[model samples]
Target chain A: MLKNLAAKAIVPVGLTVTGFVIVCSILLYSYVKQDLVADSIQREVLLGDIIVKATRFSMLTDQRESLRQTINDIGEQKGVEHVRIFNKKGVIMFSSNDEEVNQLVDMSAPGCIECHSGPVTAVHLGPMDQARNFVNAQGEPVLAITTPIYNEPNCSNGGCHFHAPDEKILGTLDIGMSQAPLLKSLATLRVRLVIFCLMVLVLTVGGVIALLQRNVLLPVRQLVYFADQVSRGNLEINEPEGTEELVSLAGNFKRLARRNLEADDSLRDLQDKLDTLTRQIREREIGHKSGN
Target chain B: MGFLRNVRRPPDTPNRAETAAAPGRERIRRLHRLAYRGLWGMAAFLALSLVAFNHGWLLPPISDGARAVLGKAPPTNLISIALVVYSFSALVLILSRMSTGQGKYKGWSHLAYLGAFYVFYHYGNALDANFWAVFAAGLTIMALEHYQMWTFCTEAIRKEEERLAQAERLEKFKS
Candidate 1:
């Protein structure tokens, strides 16, 4: 059964298409996942930058209540997990979560690891040291982006602020965004892609099989039956009709059968003539003998 | 026993040319059978080579320079075109036979086989499964036609030889 042409054709085609689908799925999933994560990180970073800008005046004026109110309001927006401002010493100066305010953040935490673990001093934090992923206490995946607030000349020169000429990094603003909605949408997209690939595969295989049956297998079967009949000395077989190849073959077979039949008829005619001639000669010889 | 009787009663004269040409005719018939067999052998070889080339088992050693000269299309396209040309030639041969009613061979049938081979070899990669199915069907038909032609030729030759022998004997008896 495996040696059959249909099996041979279908198996290889099916395998190749399946391999293509799997490879496409892997590549597409990775690409979409990467794109979604990158986009999410960019949005969160922009939000953190805006929050840092908004709270800069409050922080410099020593209005702790205003800074706390801004953080809480921003965190109430959809998809924002939390918004916090951590001082240079990794102390949570203000937080949307009231309990987290006035607490000391770990140096190894997602918001602090970028500047603390590296050889570079925390005072010279760059944009690359601002993003990390971690699971929140609620067990949801979160992307945190940190924006560093730099000490400006005005803050140091102004009469209300203390005299510090070289305070480059004042603090970091960390924004944590929930990734649940994005992941759910990605899962839905993946399911749709799988369904599309499967549909394509089924349609392609079905069309191939249908064409094969029509143009190849069915005609071939008819020709075989005709050939069998001819083999049994039944010269009265009808020619098969289908593709050009099969039609030509059946036509040739019919002609060959006719030729064989004609050859047999001619041979029979010759044998009959020879037998009659032999009998006439024998009878003539017998009459001649009797007369003598 | 038949040979003894004919020798004892040698009644008629024989055509000297017919007697002399008998062996030559027999040789010609043998050569014709050999030619058919050789044609089939060549066809089989071509079929196998086509299959091997299509499946990548047989790769022609073409250097990068040669490939550059040949362009990007697969070399099998050239082979398919050649086969198509050969099939056309076969078509002409078959037409000639039909007009003359001389040769018993089915050149058109061979043309069909070659055409199918061209299709399978040229477009098989794109068509995939349909290629194998069509190839199998075409090959089977070609094989059957070959057998039928072989049987027909053999039978016709045998019958002709028998008729000639009987006619010669009758002529001898009458004369």
Candidate 2:
């Protein structure tokens, strides 16, 4: 098998491989890049879903402690790394584990001076963290979620609970989730992807090699077999289906073999004819001498 | 190239002169030459990993910059694949150069084994049936391979020769 592959791949198989390598390298390069980004984005989206669900549940319940606790429980899931919550003011009201959220935070402001729209960290969301914003720190990503605490309407009825109207600005909540486990899982996925890519390249190239192996090896072997028959002065072999080029080649080889055979036969026949003539002439000469 | 080209002809045939002068010896020479070329091509392919997988620090730095930009590197995917690809291409280049002269041997079946190996190696870890299967298949090809070559070198000459004669005669009649 090795020899056959070696033989067949030596020709078109090898060339195909070279072309495939060049072509696939470029393709795989781009694919790998897109694959990485897509993968990270997918992970982030999954975590984001987790945060949204936790926040939504807390909003329905109307309890800060329960909301914060629920988010914490979900963050500590087998794959969840960290979780944190922020209020409408962008204050880190509650955190999974990071103690940096003890300071005052305000999210009512417009854009993030650093990562206003995405995962980048540079904007100030708190008075204490005005220098360094509430971004991901030490492999732990803090997802800022802002929720409003409404004042009871009955208190503003001038009877039971509230005092004024908009003065019921309760508190803010913040949540941060560690990205380590998620990143780690993604790393594993990347390894698997690499392996899968390797397999694909290998199998595809291998299949090509297998095809050429038989195509080149078999026909050439047939040509050789045909040649061997003619080489020994045997001129009765039919040409193998060596295609136009090989068929023509076989035709030439056969012609040469037959020509050599005919030339040798003709020369032998001529030698015999000369020997008989010489014998007859010598006999006649000897007889005349004896009679004289 | 020498080894592949060499294998296309038998050692005893040496050259066309010998082919004309002594056909028997010529056949032997061609056989040897073909074997030699095949061997040489393999030798070159085996040497590819030495350069591609050298792991030298200067071999070519991967894009740490891409990692920083994307927040993560591609996890050795590109480098490992580049290595495998380089090796496969080396195999192709060496073989093609050697076998250019062989029209019959220029087809694809002979190369099937290499491609199979590439696939096998890729999934060997995942599938767990890699080396053994490859070895078995390779050994099978080896067993059945030269059986035909020897037969070709010895027996088929006479039949082909007769066809060649008739062909030449027809050509002469046409002219």
Candidate 3:
């Protein structure tokens, strides 16, 4: 894209046009990436904070429902795709986007395996990657973290994802935030990086081209002009003394001039000798004719 | 696939003889004037009528229905709209210049007017008033055709042509 003649022209001015575009692209990509990441992290942390707090409640009371509403409010933040709830047993309790999956999610397997069927951590799954641990229950760069909650009864009893008969322990509170926003942030970052790279590449290319055109091509063109002069018998034209390269060029021109001078001298001597012979021949012819 | 097969290939070189026989650029311009000016006038009229009928002929026609559907009507500063209009006019000027093949001086009084208007609207209360950015960074690219109208001054192009012609003529004469 930068290889156009317009880009070539700019080389003499400063950076090539192509170089300027590349630099702009790189800067744009970096800026997009930074903004996207920042937005995603903000949303994720907000969601996680709200979810972790909500989990502490045991009953399926209005308060528990309110927790979903609170998360829904937070979910509206830019870049947030969805908010979800999971029990310790890995059952999906409430989801902001999908209402059908009221089934039990198996949280038995450690890490992300228990609930997520896809390539474990690759997707945003598990109580952890969805943010099972971190400050405000939100994780860092890897995934959002949030505290898993079981009802007080379940907590007061032994350790389990749910409650027993008369063992009225509330379900484990798991908040699954949409990683889409985070991924989007990352994608934006990727684009920004690409733009940044393009900008740098362009600037570098422009700078290099500019230098080459000014310092190399212009001088070489001048040298060519002088060489043409030498070829046309005007060997008196002076060569540049800018560098060793120029010095060598001047030497070559000098040699060609000397050779031409030598050839001219030889031709002149031959012409003179021919004229003298002609005169002698004419004189002999005249003297012989008179005797006859 | 069918379209691809049916697509005709462009000739390697234009048929100069046929073009030479055709009417001049002025005739072409007259034809364009008849065709597009009428079409644009009609289209703009209809669009305005439809909008006015639905939401009254005035500024900020944020329909209640729209508000109901979107939760809130997407709010935009009216001054921004005026600025956009000015930028659009400048873009049109630029296009005119380009069509005449003499584009230059893209930033004209109209663009400044738009920015000033934008500031006038946004000035009193609070907020940043920067409409030049809209014209330069946004509208210029969108309305590339018009940018030339404002930028492509006739004198500039004529001078360039004169210089080029003189140099070529001088070179040939020397040769």
Which model scores highest in TM-score?
1
> CA lDDT of A261 in candidate 3?
81
Candidate 1: tens digits of C-alpha lDDT, residues B39-68: 674487456546644654444444669658
Q: Write the per-residue lDDT of candidate 2 for residues A1-292, one digit (tens) a residue.
A: 3335454444343334344444344345445544654555455545554566556545544566886687667767753445555543456656666574665543334322333445543333432222121345454543333323334454345342334676543433332334454456666765765566566657766777666555655677888999999999777788988457778888999998999999999999999999999999999999999999
Candidate lDDT values, in order? 0.67, 0.49, 0.48
Model 3 ranges off by over 4 Å: A1-50, A53-147, A150-154, A157-170, A176-191, A241-243, A288-292, B1-175
Q: List the residue pairs that clash in candidate 1.
A: B12-B172
lDDT of 3 at A166: 44
lDDT score, residue B103, model 2? 18
Worst 10 residues of 1 chain B by lDDT: B126-135
Please list the residue runs of candidate 2 whose C-alpha ends up more than 4 Å from where it truly belongs after superposition. Answer: A1-80, A85-93, A98-174, A178-210, A242-244, A288-292, B1-175
Docking class of 2: incorrect
Report how far residue B111 has shifted in candidate 2, in Å. 30
- A56-163, model 3: which lDDT tens digit per residue? 452333355676666567557654444566654456666665563477654444334433445542322333244432222243223343334434443455443335
> For this target, which candidate reaches the highest lDDT against the unseen true structure?
1
Give candidate 2's TM-score.
0.42
Off by over 4 Å in 1: A122-129, A232-238, A274-292, B1-175
